[model samples]
Target: AQSVTQLDSQVPVFEEAPVELRCNYSSSVSVYLFWYVQYPNQGLQLLLKYLSGSTLVKGINGFEAEFNKSQTSFHLRKPSVHISDTAEYFCAVHYSGTYKYIFGTGTRLKVLA
Candidate 1:
């Protein structure tokens, strides 16, 4: 079974600061990487994905991630983050054939005013 690991459980940053949320995965076969965000009590929203072709994938809310196959990592980053960006970020990987999703523990981003 595939799995994802979010290196940071929580991240605290001031408004307008840069942030990076680390994500790593382990899989035996080809996989699809995804980044999703969840606001308080809200459903998860797709942020970005890496199905194929590009290594660097751009996502919503000024977020982006680079899929490094060699490292099995897809770290999310934002050049400048706002208070509204505060949310729980999850890294998920889907098995190409099974279509089953394996999600990371989650990284909580707390933006301070």
Candidate 2:
């Protein structure tokens, strides 16, 4: 079975500082990954994704991730963050023929001032 792991349960970073949320996945076949953010009381929204092509991919709100095939990881990063960025971030993996995503436990990014 395929699985994803978010190493951190909570990542508290000061407002306007840099942050990185780790995501590691394991699969037997080819896989794609995605990063989704869910604000308080809201459903998850797509933050970024890794499908094919370049290792580095960018997304909305100044976020980006690099897919490392050898490491089987796709880690999201932001050079700076705002208080509004505080939310629960999830890492999901989709195998070649799967229709659904396998998500990690998620990491709550707390942007403190």
lDDT of each: 0.92, 0.94
Across 6-36, the per-residue lDDT of candidate 1 in tens digits comes to 9899999999989999999985578899999
Cα lDDT tens digits for candidate 2, 1-113: 67899999999999889999999998447898899999999999999888889999999999999999989999999999999999999999998887888999999999999
Ten-residue region with minimum lDDT total, candidate 1: 24-33
Per-candidate total of colliding backbone pairs: 0, 0
Best by lDDT: 2
Q: Judged by TM-score, which candidate is best? A: 2
* CA RMSD of all predictions: 1.0, 0.9
Model 2 misplaced stretches (Cα beyond 4 Å): none
- lDDT agreement of model 2 with the native: 0.94
lDDT of 1: 0.92
* Over 4 Å off, model 1: none
